[model samples]
Target: MPRERELILGGQRSGKSRRAEQRAADWLALDPAHRAVLIATATAHDEEMRERIARHRADRAQRVPGLVTVEEAVRLGPALARHSEPGTLVLIDCLTLWLTNLLMPAESGSASPALAETAHAGLLHALHGARGPVLLVSNEIGLGVIPMGREARAFVDALGRLNQAVAGACDRVTLMAAGLPLRLKEPG
Candidate 1:
């Protein structure tokens, strides 16, 4: 059977993550050797972020026992290549954060478009060649009002483009709202 590639997008608290996890569980239950791996992109740079990460970890433990997690903040292509296999299910929770990490000025003090472009290209390439099922989660932030700040606007623009590219590559695309999934695209 051909592998499935799905893109899940939603607003805050829309349950996109939960839906992805459930799908992963279902995929793993199909075969004894099927493995589920989470590719986490968020970094705990602040107390709130740390707490959020902890909560996600706890929730995963309670919900998906067989799921393994791999933290790859920037180098996503290599990570995807390393984990994806015929009987494996790879879930990438939140791409918006990864874009933020790329666009936001780091300790070195400036954002690098060249780096972001490279990562984006790498991700698309990896997704196209994935041997197993892949699920990607990202926020639908473009639904809100336009931001007043330049950086915020830039982020929204970048995220919008990224989402579009991924959605085009995916065989299925779902939009979550109020914990309900509305299918946007499905394989014909």
Candidate 2:
């Protein structure tokens, strides 16, 4: 069992993902030969999102010179389970999108609780069973007013629950804001 599980959470534009990436890069710097596993959760749903994803990819390339990025829009647990190993640092960029993907409908149908439950179980299993460092980035959506719709409320509720579940299993947890890290949990 490798000792590496971290969580970073913050509001939008809070530089949470950047902070997570920087920490991952720093960890890799200590051991240059360690494999860099970047699990991207963003989906290219629209032109704006596609551009944002593209920019994020470019930034990752520039920041971490030799990074391996794996784009898994929905099934992240399987991907993480497959690539996680000793001497590897897996950095997952934004769990919010992944949660959305897991909770949202494929076409126009209603969001299925059974599917979300399965995805949640898979993610937790992967995180707890990982063999190397796993840094997960996610948004803190509970800082705002109550949502105006049932779906939005359900999504927020699910995300908050998921964040808590991951954080509970992490060795260290940090909240980023304006590119600064506020340590929530630190290794003993």
Candidate 3:
């Protein structure tokens, strides 16, 4: 097998992020030289968010000893391209936050579509062109009822489409629930 492109999808508190981290650690174990890049896509805008981000970072550090963590909430493609080496194992915590950053209040009026498209294009380009193994984490929100507001609806729709595109390109797809992983696709 060349390098694995993995997508781990699940709902909130479904343990998807934990699975992604574990997978990255496993991938890095085979080759210690393979750097573990944690592309954290969250910015702590409030106290709760700050605490959540901190706990996650701490947990990741403990889980993957000596793993290098890079915090690039935005500018994902360029960040990955610049920081990654040939054998790097890149782990993106969640695509949902990245989408939020691109599609949030600043993009309120009619400017959202173009901005979101550009961001999505950049993300897709990165996923396809990344140098080494990549494990992307995202929420599976489409399983629930449609969101009430336009922003929420758009977010869910965009995430669903993005997940589909990534999963199609990926070599492996895993869904997590209650911290257990259900492997959907694996290399034959």
Q: For residues 1-188, could you state the per-residue lDDT of candidate 2 as single tens digits? A: 14579999999999887787787778778876777789998877679988988898898889987678999987888998998999888888879988887778555556677887898889899999998999999999999999999889989999999999999999999998887889999887
1-188 per-residue lDDT for model 1 (tens digits): 24889999999999999999999889878888899999999988889989999999999989999999999888888898889889999999889888877888455568887898899999999999999999999999998899999988988999999999999999999999999999999998
Candidate 3 local lDDT, 45-76, one digit each (tens): 78999898889878888998756778776678
Question: Which one wins on TM-score?
Answer: 1
Instruction: Write down the TM-score of every candidate.
Output: 0.97, 0.94, 0.91
lDDT of each: 0.91, 0.86, 0.80
Winner on TM-score (1 vs 2): 1
Error of 1 at 20 (Å): 0.1
Candidate 2 stretches with Cα past 4 Å from truth are: 106-109
Q: Report the poorest 10 consecutive residues by lDDT, candidate 2.
A: 103-112
For model 3, state the Cα shift of residue 120 in Å.
1.1
Candidate 1 residues lying further than 4 Å off, grouped into runs, are: none
Please identify model 3 stretches exceeding 4 Å from their true place.
105-111
Q: State the displacement of the C-alpha of residue 183, model 1, in Å, after optimal TM-score superposition.
A: 0.4
